[model samples]
Target: MKTLYKNYINTFKGLSDEIWWLALITFINRAGTMVIPFLSLYLKEDLNFSVSQVGWIMSAFGLGSVVGSWIGGKLTDKIGYYKVMVRSLLATGVLFIALQFLNTFVSLCIGIFIVMMVADAFRPAIFVALNTYSKPENKIRSLTLIRLAINLGFSAGPAIGGMIITGLGYAGLFWVDGITCVLAALVMIKVLNPKKAKVLDELKNDNPVSVYKDHAFLVFFIAMVLFGIVFLQYFSSITIYYKDVHLLSEFEIGLILGMNGFVIFIFEMPLIKWLERTAFTKLWLVFFGAVLTGISFLILNFTSWSGILIIGMLLVTFGEMVAFPFSNAFAIERAKKGNQGEYMALYSISFSVAHIFGHNAGLQLSAGIGFENTWYIITGLAFICAVLLFSLNRRLNNLKKIQL
Candidate 1:
């Protein structure tokens, strides 16, 4: 027993205090997401908004996210993650509090957009901090683990938000988010200590030198934008499929949707370790994983078995766990030293741009082409997107060897 106890304590003796703070910041930042995952339902069921109206509102939030990422990049370059994070959290909390007083659609929409602005901006700031905190020896794994923390919070936040909505209501969800935001601000204020930059260097801050001019970062950014379109479908296309099919009870649909996050939680860490070496190897694992995900949409249409649908969602989890971190890690790898904020923000734009199309067009495509066929089309398109990305990778590999 003594030897076992000593071994356990020995395991983490030299662990970086910085990583612990990163994890804590992650927990605090993500706890605010308790409101977002339930946002669709809250708009429709709680506030009696129409489906189209809901989509419009969601687009507003996405817009906020884009502006947030852009502003965060400039500001993080200007100041640092510490001030950006504190202000973002505090502002998000105030916006959530404002939601409690509004009943009008425009009121809710604008409020939600404002809140999303701050919430979304914090994301790149976080990516910047985490990317800087590690050496190359462990940066990929470090990035993977931090993403895992966010998903872990996202997995539980919805269920807990659901319970609160049931027990107390939408008002309750806001209160939960508001409380978390304030707490996150406090935690960041006290614990997220970053190394001070040289004063002269800080004073001369100009436009972040284009890391993209270097080829690897540019090609990776292009590929990530394509990947974004494929990945954004879960919330946009798949949910629409579930509702349009009407093949299950509300409870059943909830379970199916809920299972995606569940599988992500189960597989994320183990798979993160597995993919770390693989991404350094052939790079096809990431490609194959994207194929699995795109095909799973088509599979969901053919199967009625609960088991198959669950399995299909598992494939998405598998694909997601593979592609998402690697994509981010790939970006971080080629980013300019000390410009993790701008790199992450630029990377984030791909996801935002992808959704700009996915959210606005996905539903209309499903409506026009039929939901089943839309999956077929999407699967085909996903392959094309993947091909584009891989093509970029091949073209840029020679250039990548130049500096990085």
Candidate 2:
């Protein structure tokens, strides 16, 4: 027990203070992420929108994210991450508050698009910040630490959000979301002095390669989009499934979702630390993670027992712990060879693109083909994603050998 405890503690030994602060900021922001987990329910039950309409609005949310990621990437390259992060957070805070007022379909779509555009701009900028703040060897662990913070906050967010929805309604969610964004920004301003930080030198390449032209990276990008599509359903269609199929309440659904975060919060850092010390390549780990995610959804098709929900969530949580941090490290490493901001932007955009397709497609499929078939389809996509990542891993290995 002592040995186990010591090993777990060792996982956090080397990350910088800036990285810790970054994680704290992420925690503050994500803890108030009450609106998103329940957004589909809000539109369906409260606003009386159809599933199809909900899909479209979610797609609009993705469109905004794509644009935000692109603009944020460009600005980070030109002005630095510090400015981009502060501005994005502050703007997003105001937009969240404004978002609660829109009731009509067109207005809600536009409002969410604008809010997400501003909000998601923070994604790539923070990635760049991670690069600047972390030591080279500790990069992946640092990513895991930040993810831990996100999950920790997420664990709290949904349970609290469910209670808020039960008591004060969805409007309360919007207010809390907006306030947290503003608070996170203020903390960023008070804590991080970007001027005093040491920026790492990019890998020496007199002729830098554009992210658009990188064949290996393009393959990885496609895989990430597929992964995102499969993973994002937990937020969209899965919640609906929990509600309609299992006849769970909003608070019960929140607990199940919160369970995903809580599992990751406890297990991810140690798991990541152990994985890093192993001989398994990062992409191989990613491939395994993808397979596990596919299986998570596949199991849902087998049982209607609400108990299975916990099991599926556990599988997905472990898959997430294994997949995301390594994927992030891979992207950052690739970015180091060229333009960090642009590379990370494209990376963020891959998930944004997933958002564009994933939420809408999952909901539509659920509405059209029924939830069982939708899970089967999503399970198939997850396997396809795993195959792609496996191919990309081999391709990268071949390229490395050729270079040697």
Candidate 3:
């Protein structure tokens, strides 16, 4: 037992202090992610919006995220990641407060859009920070640490947020979420020095590289978008499905979602270390992730029991553990030294675009057709992503030879 515990500790050893601080920042920021998980419910129940209206509002958030990531990437290169992160965190907190006053559909959409644009800007900036701080070989582990922080905080946030919602309503959710973002901003301001976080001299240059020019990466980006379309359903359509179809309460739903974070928190670090030592290539890991993700949702079709939801979430968490960090490492590897922000920004865009495409499209489909049919569509899409990622194994194998 002692030896096993020591080995687990060693799995996370060797990362820089900057990486640890960044992970801490992620934990602080994600811990208050109360608004988003409950947004669909707020829009549907409190505002009495239809499924399509909720979709439109959610897409607005996605659009903002897209814009924020693009601009954040540009700014991180021109200014620095620390500045972008600080500004984004502070601004997003303010917007969360503003959301409490906006009640109309159009107003809510506009409010959510601005809030998400500011909030989601943090993504690329943090990735750029991870790249700048960690050694090339340690990139995956560094990123996994960030995800670990994220999931750990995610595990806490929703369970707490569910209680807050029960006690004080949506206004309380916004207030708490806002406060947490501001706190994260304060931490960034005090801890992250922009001068120190700046790009290294040899890697620093003014010239910009267009991500679209890389054919291989572009194809990979497309596959990720498809993957995200299926993956992000947990945030958008699945919550509604849990309530409307399964008749679960909000607390129960949060528990189910929290299980995703719990499972990731326990297994991600060790599993990633294991994968690094094995014959499995990065893209193949992603292929298996997609297969697992598909199977998780597919299980729901066969079983409506509450225990099945936990099983499905566990499978989905395992898939996320395998795919996301490695995929992030791939994008960072693809970047020119000076343009890490742009490369990661492009990667973040896949997720943002997926949110826009998937949430809106999935909601419409669910409302028009049915939830079971939606799961079928997601299952098919996941397999398609798996095949696409599999085709890239040769290229990815060649990439492994190049030092990131």
C-alpha TM-score for every candidate: 0.84, 0.98, 0.95
lDDT at position 395, candidate 3: 70
The order by descending lDDT is: 2, 3, 1
Give the whole-model CA lDDT for all candidates, comma-separated.
Answer: 0.67, 0.92, 0.86
lDDT of 1 by residue, 211-328 (tens): 5565656655665666666666666555545554655443455456556666665666556655554635324555666777787776867866656667777777778787777777
Candidate 1, residue 357: lDDT: 63
lDDT tens digits, residue span 280-301, model 3: 8778898899999999889999
lDDT of 1 at 219: 58
**Candidate 1, RMSD to the unseen true structure:** 4.3
235-294 per-residue lDDT for model 2 (tens digits) = 899999999999999999999989989989879998898899999888999999999999
Clashes of 3: 0
Quickly count the clashes in candidate 2: 0
Clashes of each: 0, 0, 0
